[model samples]
Target: MKTLNDLLQLGDPRLYEVCEPVQENELPMVKEWVADLHNVMEEIRAKYKFGRGIAAPQLGIMKRLIYLNLNTPSGSVPYIIINPVFENLSEELFELWDDCMSFPNLLVKVKRHQSLTIKYLDENWQPKVWKVEGAISELLQHEFDHLEGILCTMRAIDNQSFKWRPTPDSN
Candidate 1:
């Protein structure tokens, strides 16, 4: 089982390296990787109380993959996105306080497209496309950025657009 300690922190050179697309031959190997991602994501959620998704590069996988567990009215839906490509991005933008699994204790204000159309391979290596907006769109964008070697900190609205996560006492 993976732990939060398996995650690459900010300033880690591996996190800054662009990931390679997952090839068909490697489909058999993705299950274990996804499991590792899931394990670490759970650890992050239990410790920091916040974690929607995680990218493979964050764990030194060096592959274009992301694991997202989205909360819905019914329950959580987990998605394993492989080799994702942004098919479309809305012209309009929205700003939000975004946090990352790589830097769990920091929040960065950044602007992201209001909506996006993404094409990616599912866990079965089947093609899938999702037109998403709001929180889902934001989450996908954040994970996709990781595949491109971009971090939320690099997208900060300004130098002052960062703050530490507030503790229970501070709240």
Candidate 2:
């Protein structure tokens, strides 16, 4: 299994392809991917202060999987969501400035819902549901887009409209 340090970043064409649906026979591989993803997130969090989430494509895997570790005072733990589905998205949208590991350092303002209800399988393969709002919701939408071969850059309000910011530790 590759550590987070070894995970590939975005911009690789592999990140742009649609992932195959998870099958009963592939459960073991999916579990392994989840483990590796958690390791990747851990590595990222150790180096960066605010890396709360990551998607499969960000790791060079064209699969509908994501791992998020929302930072909270109590301490954060990773949540692995496989083949996630979003529901109850509001038509009422908000424009949040965002960036991607794939497009590194570029920030774009993209439209997103303020809240969402999501359904996905947990690590144990049991059905789980979550309702998220605020920045977390935006993050999920951003990661989910990767599964569909979409990038925030494509939805930029306009060319030259967004700004680029370096990662937290960049000098």
Residue runs of model 1 more than 4 Å from their true location after superposition: none
TM-scores of all candidate predictions against the true structure: 0.97, 0.85
Report the Cα lDDT for candidate 1. 0.93
Top candidate (lDDT): 1
Model 1, span 1-171: residue lDDT tens: 567788999999998889999999999989999999999999988888998999999999999999998888999999999999996799999999999988888999999999999999999999999999999899999999999999999999999999999964675
Point to the candidate with the largest TM-score: 1
Error of 2 at 45 (Å): 3.4
| Model 2 local distance difference test score | 0.77
Cα lDDT tens digits for candidate 2, 103-125: 55568988899999999987678
Which ten contiguous residues of candidate 1 have the minimum total lDDT?
162-171
Report the error of model 1 at residue 84, Å. Answer: 0.3
lDDT of each: 0.93, 0.77
